[model samples]
Target: MSRPLIYKGRGSLGNAAGRFEKHTRRAEDDGWGSLDAELPPLQTEIIVDSSQSVISYNDSPDIPFDRSINPYRGCEHGCIYCFARPSHAYLGYSAGLDFESKILIKPEAARLLREEISKRAYRCAPLALGTNTDPYQPLERRQRIMRGILEILAQTRHPVSIITKSALIERDLDILAPMAEQGLAAVYLSVTTLDRTLARKLEPRAAAPQRRLETLDRLRAAGVPTGVMVAPLIPVLTDPELEAIVSAAHAAGAQSAAYILLRLPLEVADLFEEWLRQHYPLKAEHVMRRVRDNRGGKAYDAAFHQRQSGSGVYADLLAQRFRLVCRGLGLTGDLPALRTDLFRKPHAGGQMSFDFFD
Candidate 1:
């Protein structure tokens, strides 16, 4: 791994220059460790910006929800395979470690969500969370942005669907439980793999698989509609565990299940390649070969319909495996639609309509 050079009181450009100097010195010294042996502790920086609007609209035919909200930019989960990793390039940052360490929080998200929904043109639909980045990432613990958004949704009696890999959702059972009772909420717990060691390295900041299972149980017990998402099923890496993961999630009280095949787009391809070489060096070549087979002899194929699930015999087999296991486990192929009929706009000075009903 190439160590990022740090320059005290200097920005990224200065740091790069320092790295060049260090490289020259190391080459002259015949590859010896620096005499000052201590490495700097990794620091996470968060900048909170107040977004004018929270709800973002999407017209993609492949996605289920038309509207979504992301409370934070650049996830802390550190999943190398995340297709959203490429988004960090817009910020002039590397999609590798920088994508996980530099986080942007939307502090005014809740207020903006309320304002958007109160508009006369606003239509009722299930608002999705964690679509681009996990809404319940570790930073949410302190920022409470997701919680604030949920609170607004609850206040308006709006429908919501969340996809997350964190146990932090348990903390909002007070809000989710009530919303679920009214058919206003559903949750999807994303479990990529059951292997603890692999999960630790692949998704360093995410909650453990076991903890996620427990979270599902808690949500089910609380009467919150819940399901499991075995997302981005890697070709050779976690593919073999498809059935096992579905069966285990079923046993853990997941009412439905879904999966997405691995997608390597833009910077994500290079980032994932680096990760495979670093962690699964022995299987690196095999994995990339299978991935290419799925992608029609390339690292990725970005055609609209073919983007989510690749095209090939390997992709077909993976889909077949998922369908068979899901049926055997008696899990619903898709989540029940959250009720949008219950939605109401909350006014600034007046109480919400639901409050009068209460």
Candidate 2:
């Protein structure tokens, strides 16, 4: 059966197509003529992921935050280049389409966060939301865990930073706007490309480029500190749109800008390679050639300082261009610090506390 390169409203699962040595979901010939040749309809499955805690701490020097919270494990937005795809393997799921369709949810994220934050030794620092899989993925509209976490952060006056590409975030402005008023929150909306067609094929389920721009404007108008992240900059595919994206975002009220180079780590490398072969067959070889150029002749370089920004001719040039364009548009601005001193644990109402116990 001839598999489809693109699905209408969804991203193609990486597991169903292409050749890889190892995979949990195996495709077999059903001997059903056209049915065998056609891509089957895929459905999204949300599984409950019970957790012992919600907050995850990281000490990576390159990452700005020491802690983050991922309300879900696998992302349904299905960006083919997602570095988080490999995370699904730990759950015995394929990192391809299975990673996009099979999701894991932390049902008690908000409650656990409240418990963690209310502990005596817990010190406040800027915690990032959506640092791994997007906490505001399409499923967030229904799950609302992200909103719950935001509520807990709001009630405790804990500072946070959010990064996402979903327009659903606009739905939480009531919580976000009020928090923004006190410098407790900021947002960085990501726009990968201005071309809608390319965006559909690339990110599959993410909002359109124009919609993200509108969201940026709305966030800024609501007094939320907004910025733009032109992330996972593919060498030949979306790299050309860098300057234009930065300029548009700046005009849309983005106060600052940042970017990360394409990272084809582990299973993601195989998935993206197959994706390139399917969509950009003409330039697949050329594209990966440049990717390797930036990755130091390897599929990826995990070196911390050198990882976020790669090392190569094109990488150096891209950095130079980003700096020049950001400076020209004044996308660099001093951001207000999120207030840790404002943190006050939520009072467990109606709970008995002995007066002068000790």
Candidate 3:
């Protein structure tokens, strides 16, 4: 049998078609030499998103915030276990390689946000960034969409929260630090694993674990409220580092911490399983067995409360451990609440409303 092809820096090994596609295509090796011919590395393709609006709102009980801004549609970090992967299918793209290699950017995000929030019926609340994808992903360096959005948020004195796995956020400390000083900003760095090798495989293009910790420290020093998320705590793969991750974040100046059980919604299940079979063949079966144990003998359970942290002996133990470690490290509280009272809706002419001094 032909061995599976591996792309050096990419996370997904295959590019299966999106579920909504009416037809599917498969690669087949024929007698000709073309099938196995060496091909050039795939390049990232940037597509402009022509969305008229910038803010997305959701009422899911599991989510802490109602409104969020995703400057980009597909994430370049290419984490195989990302629950957001399935969302790519809606754009007629695969949940695997295509999701990482094909990016959609909203160049007008800041303008749209300003228009939306300046409306008479608009309400002020803490808007979230990097919820569906990393706002600081590599393209942000060239696109600068996120920076423009932050500039508007800062100008309006609007409350904003962010989560990212990239060190690129440091570049915006000038904007974030001042907003944070006014209780209008909070940031969370998502640390998957401290193992360099695993991180390279899991999120090939994201920042290194140690670099994220250092970034957290810098944010804290700048007076930016910092939090750490030991996300997607895989059972056999990353469970052992639970306490270590919390302790390390505390030492790195994180004021709060949280975690999520591995989620395998839709195509993410197959992609993640394939990744395990390729990277951890020996422990693949055991890892999945434990995952199913946490999911009540299934690959996943989509129930809101049960989804973040499954319901089982192992899940219970993991939660108890997290609580204990957080308590010991004084990480038991949430990040300080963001301020919405200071929000100022700029007029159509780009000046603030005149009722301030009255």
- Candidate 3 residues 1-358, lDDT tens each? 2434467778998888899999876566666765577756879999999999999999999999999999998989988889999999999999989899999999999999999999999999999999898999999999999999998898888999999999999999999999999999999999989999999999999999999999999999999999999998999999999999989989999999999999999899989999999999998999999999999999999998999999999999999999999999889899999999999887777665545322
lDDT of 1 by residue, 1-358 (tens): 2443332221121111111122322112224666335446557789776668888899988889899999998888878688887777666666655677778899989888888888888999999999999999989999999999998888888999999999999999999999999999999999999999888877877899999999999999999988999998999999998998888889999999988889998767766876787668999999999999999999999887788888999999988898888878888467677888877788865456656245
**lDDT score, residue 123, model 2?**
94
lDDT for predicted candidate 3 compared with the true structure: 0.92
> Candidate 2: deviation at residue 314, Å?
1.1
In order of appearance, the predictions have TM-scores of: 0.90, 0.92, 0.96
lDDT of 2: 0.85
Ranking by TM-score, best first? 3, 2, 1
Q: Please report, as a residue range, the 10-residue window in candidate 1 with the lowest summed lDDT.
A: 10-19
List the pairs of residues colliding in candidate 2. 1-37, 2-37, 13-97, 14-96, 14-97, 15-97
Candidate 3 all-Cα RMSD: 2.0
Per-model lDDT: 0.82, 0.85, 0.92
